[model samples]
Target chain A: MNAGQQTTRRLVSRTGPSICRSCLDTLSRQPYSTAAAAAIQTEPQEALPITPPTPSPSYALHAGILVSRPPLLTRPPHPFESAYHLYQKRLNERLALPFTRYFYIKKNTPGDLEWKRKIKQRLTPARDIGRYRGYGDEAWNDEVLVGAQESEMAWQVERLLEDAERDGGEEEGKKGEGVQTVGGPKKLEREPVERPMPRVTEADEKGDVRSLGRLLQRSLYLVVKNKEGEWVFPQDRLIGKESLHNAAERVLVQSGGYNMNTWVVGNVPVGHYQHDFVPEHLAKSANPTELGLKTFFMKVRIMAGQADLKSNKLGLTDFKWLAKEEVQKTVDEKYWRSIKNMLAER
Target chain B: MALRELPSRAASAVLHNSRPAVLALRPSGRRNASSEALRDVESSSSFEVPFVSDSLVKAFDPIERSKRRRLGKKPLPPSRYQFRPPKYYRGPLHPHQPPPSSDPVSREFIPGPFASPRLEQTYQSTIASDLMTLTYHHLPPGYRAPVQLQRLREWTGDSPYFKGRPLRPPRGGGGLRLLDPPRNFKNIPEITKVVVHSMVPEAQDNSAHLHVAGMIVQAITNVRAVTHKARHNVVGWGLREGKYVSVTADVEREDTFHFLSKLIDVVLPRIKEWKGVAGTTGDSSGNITFGLTPDVVAMFPEIEVNYDSYPPKMIPGCHITIQTTATNDRDARFLLQSVGLPFYGKLVD
Candidate 1:
């Protein structure tokens, strides 16, 4: 026999010890038996061609009692597990840390004033009254005298001039006699004046007037009034599992209707404020929980999309770009004091 | 008598002023002549009338003269003075006064009973509120919205702003397009090493048990297993320092891949009751460790075929640690998954 046939015969003898020479001879007589046909039918269509007939009598023994079968059974299907399971397991096994909330205290730009002006003009025109006043004709009129007695002295000089012109010859003769009586030669000599009087031009005669006073502008803080009518800055809670800066940006988008891609958010917090109280919505719920809410206020500059303030889902009832004084009047005293410096002009 | 002397004083002033005028009228006159004439006129004055010339006044009081000059030549009203508002006045004045409340008061101030419900409904019906409801109600609980899903919503014009900009097509005619091949495969995963470890109890410190465990690891991994001594004493468990407590084998490169494939395809399935590896088996450094029973370890063809070579003693369970070239457990798990290993839990953020 060839090496391949000899090796197969040895493996078959080792695998199926119970199969007799007569059974093997009978199987050789009919290489394709009813049992083989049944096995082929039961096997998967693609696997049938790849799998050679089993050397053991497991398939043939079921049809004829010429050989015994081994006790080993076929293996079950094993499917590959998913990666999501590992992620969840790791998450559950992780240690918990304390919750932190971050808030953004955004700065208003010069365009904010223009926005406020436009809003005021459209919604409430009365509030658009100018914040400036002209100093009036009195401030503009620059003809005030330096001293109270200077005007009277000037008038007396003018009168003296008129009298001198009327009686020139007689007055000159008297003045000459008086001059001869009191140290004549020394009195005749004159010294140069130390200072000269400034001449007045036509422009000076008209007056050195000042222009009108400038408008008194004030810095506007972005304030929002909740459904309960309490005025507060645009803020929201920071959910767990995110960096403070990222949470702050999300809060701006979710609560302030800010677009993150368009807005330039500051990496560090400008200031921080904390308070212990239950939120209005939470307080109204069946279970009220008081929380020590800490907020790290970051600064954000809006680059686009300011007109859609009404698009925020937080249910704020009113929004106003108010000055520091106005915001103080509207919000709680303690809350205002905590964030007063942040709202001040930088 | 002093009143009678006033006429002589006026005449001397006029004569002094006239000499300068005559000097000014004659352009050709030498400066020395005018200066001499001025000195003579000043010396001739006998009556000392308290009247100071403008030049003398300027010399003595320059600041006052400049102030008057800046104020212009016209005489000013006596009553003019700098205005200073009273310290107590806090309210606005003139242009600063609050604008007349021309706009109607907001209906929010009125009692809820008197307010219009229709107006309130219209106010509440915003796109953001709708989106919030959709996200909360439509999506599965704890399911993070994937980036692609969010981008899909934005591209479909569901977002109020399209990618934070107004929803407008480019001037050149192209519209928003989806990113090609949704997955980013820049971070490819690779198998780093495979470690097989078996812990033997101190009570079972017999050489036969240790030898059998080492042989099993060596046979399955085709690598030599190293026996590790216990570092600390555990009185309750009867473990002592310097005792052989464990045997471990590390397989790398081609061997790691071969061992992993063999374990997944041949050994793992043969276990009587297998439910895949635990998801929490991985460490932070992307190495995943799992345990297999002695029966499962024996199921390896290497151990199964030559069952008689080793003594038929109870074999100890062993742990298989698969390390990957990944930064974290998530990426390691993904790599393992790609290589046909199954994991069982949801990924957290």
Candidate 2:
């Protein structure tokens, strides 16, 4: 038998000892699957055929399936581990490049192979949130963990694959620049199997990964509803009067508590209105004339009492009551004049 | 004796009067001249019979020798006091008088009511009523002082207060203190639909973009003038003419930035400058004047002016004029008086 057929037979026998396909084939032994071996032999035969199939326009349809089926699955990683996991996924998604190859390989060298095992050991379960800290802590375990668990292990694996691809790409680039192929009988020939991948600098990578969370927060607000209609925060959250003193202080805090520079607060009222605290003017028994007449008013003891009523909590601003005696002392000159003029004309 | 006394007084006067005539005669010819006139007219003794004093009477006498002189000259009359004209009165004169007003029955009087309590109260209350009921200001005095607020890293500790400070004198003393400075109105870009509307039939026109742009230019200039006077940026303004109305302002700062940026980037391109405005509502310039206060608006031919501080109704503020032209009709004359020209080109390198 030829060397190729013998090599295939040996590989097939070593690969888990399962043999169902074409047992008598000359090239069945290989590290690769039996199907792979068959495809490789069939490829050459197909390229040089004595009687080829008719060249139909429908060839495009036949080629589509072959082009789409790649070894790598591009579906995103699951996103439900933890908030940090989600954050990392989003970051990666934002930085995803359109074209480039990154892959993992088994290391056989002492320096790389041993270091890979050590790195894997370092990715243990994270015992605490803040404990895990590093540029790539999200993918690997931070200091709190010594070994990766669950999805994190997958992240580590993915990161290692990327690193390997980048290292290979760079090495290929250096080798590519130093050599050139010549077209002559005296020149040695080498097959062009692979070319160097594109370079992605750190800055360009960061730009791709950058996100704007604050911008999104400001641009859109959630609109949740119930049977009653639109939702309103409980009085405590909305007004925060009973819970706070110095109304302005409450305002400052609720408005996103001040940041180092500008307040990040939103939905602030333009000005304070007294109506929130005071009874509606229409509901009061006092005549408009009597209330209107008072020149100076004193806050009634009862008004203070009313201010505490969980139901009637004073609104945005305070309101004082006009004393009965003071209200009587006041007069509406316009009213009297209009009445007098009407009587005189009649 | 009385007659003799009269003659004595008269004779001295007569001698005094004749003194000047005697002096007038030549010293050498005086006796001859006097004798000739006296002798010709009367006896010398008769001339002498004036006062009983012989010496005085002699001064008045005419001599017989004067008769010869009389042939050439008339006799001089005896010296007498010069006739005195009547003395004039100096002080003010009074007409006939009447009795004082204390006579009661004769004096005229005006009778009416005096200081009624009701009237006084009405007046007091009217004066007490304030025109404006609401006002806002910083508290604890000098609230704008830099020391009051803590600094921020991004902030340079610059004057946020400077935004509201007046750029010029206020319209009136104790008038509307501009709490905010003038601001550019938001320019809406991509004006696919241009609508020109006016209260007056004359203002009707199809080229709304031209009218609005011209109005904006005019409004900005007017605001600049008032702003220069009041020393304020036109913080906000509303323009209304009949049913046609527009409001401009930086309601919020971030929104304002977006507005100004969009206007510069988008709306400015569509503006047509040279097109004649449609509708007769405005004069040739397309300026429609409005009032700031109700009272002020009353002065205009149109609009009802009422001075109601509560929800200020009609007040003269600024007039807006819109001038429009087609984009293809661009020329140097299309630009009106504005705070700045609407620049439409690549930013200078």
Q: Chain B TM-score for each model?
A: 0.45, 0.14
* Model number with the top lDDT: 1
* Model 2 interface root-mean-square deviation: 53.9
Which lDDT tens digits does candidate 1 get at residues B40-135? 546654423466666665465444556778695776676766443333434765442332333112211111121112212221222112222222
Over 4 Å off, model 1:
A1-346, B1-186, B202-204, B345-349
User: Mind sharing the TM-score for model 1?
Assistant: 0.25
Model 2 lDDT tens row, A180-260: 446422322334334333233353345421221112101111111112342211112223222212232333223212321
After superposition, the stretches of candidate 2 with alpha carbons farther than 4 Å from their true spots are A1-218, A221-249, A254-261, A264-346, B1-349
lDDT score of residue B183 within candidate 2: 14
lDDT of candidate 2 over B243-306, digit per residue (tens): 3333332112122223223333343334445122222232332222111222322333212111
RMSD of each: 47.4, 58.4
Shift of residue A192 alpha carbon in model 1, Å: 99
Q: Give the 10-residue window scoring lowest on summed lDDT in candidate 1 chain A.
A: A62-71
